[model samples]
Target: MYETYTTVIGTVVSDPRHRQTSTGEPVISFRVACNSRRIDKRTQEWIDGPTLYLTVSCWRRLLTGVSQAVAKGRPVIAHGQIKTNEYVTADGERRADLEMTATAVGLDLSRCVVSFEGAPGREPSVAGTTTRPVGSEVEGAGADAQTPTAA
Candidate 1:
């Protein structure tokens, strides 16, 4: 199944962890927290919901970018596919984790500033070089939000 997923700009709630798979693939994973506010009809006030926590996995070039540019408590935007993983714990309990297999990850420069790794004669720019906006939905690219499942 093919899916596309995107994440709202948020803070990295935890330190990123780098690991190698059984196949020796390098991967980095981190958690981000985003909060949304909606107005309460009766009270006519805005209230926040439980912050949404998304696990982001970076691979290959994105892995390199994330390692170089992202850190705990850093503001960032990640776009990719939402992966729901089901597993049984050692205690025999089943758990599910929501993760994003990130195709694009970047430092959100709107609020706080982040320094990028500078190579000789090069300055990194996350604006135009990093990601495509969430608004641009690619044709036939089935996003996780649009996908149907047996739930």
Candidate 2:
């Protein structure tokens, strides 16, 4: 069977959590919130639509880029497959949630700060990308943080 999906652009509502898989691969998880405002004809004023909360997961090569470029409340654009994930509780109960296995993620630097996260041993420079370090806030980023250096 085939399923339909939609793309969403918004801000990161939470910090990205990094974890290592049992096999030792890196994965990062974070949430993004997309809100929309619409005018109610009867009220003649803008009202908030349902906020979309997506759990985005990034792995392998993209992991580090996501960690460095994205942060809480930072605008971003994410595109990927969307699906509901189910899990079991300790009491044997069932739980369900939505997630997006992000194939592409980047900062919406239209009018926000750009930063680079430096992981241990792996310097930001080695990535061949010029960055201001994770905590350093650079205002008015053009796009995709600073231009990435050639591989």
Best lDDT goes to which candidate? 2
Alpha-carbon runs more than 4 Å astray in model 2: 1-5, 110-151
Q: Positional deviation of 134 in candidate 2, in angstroms?
A: 20
Question: What TM-score would you give candidate 1 relative to the actual structure?
Answer: 0.69
TM-score of each: 0.69, 0.68
- lDDT digits (tens) for residues 50-127 of candidate 1: 898889998997876677567787778888888788999999999998889888887776644333233568765433
Q: Model 1: residues >4 Å from true position, as ranges? A: 38-46, 115-151
**Which ten contiguous residues of candidate 2 have the minimum total lDDT?**
126-135
lDDT of 1: 0.72
Q: For candidate 2, what is the TM-score?
A: 0.68
- Model 1 is weakest, by summed lDDT over 10 consecutive residues, at 142-151
Q: Alpha carbon lDDT of residue 121, candidate 2?
A: 92
Error of 2 at 55 (Å): 0.7
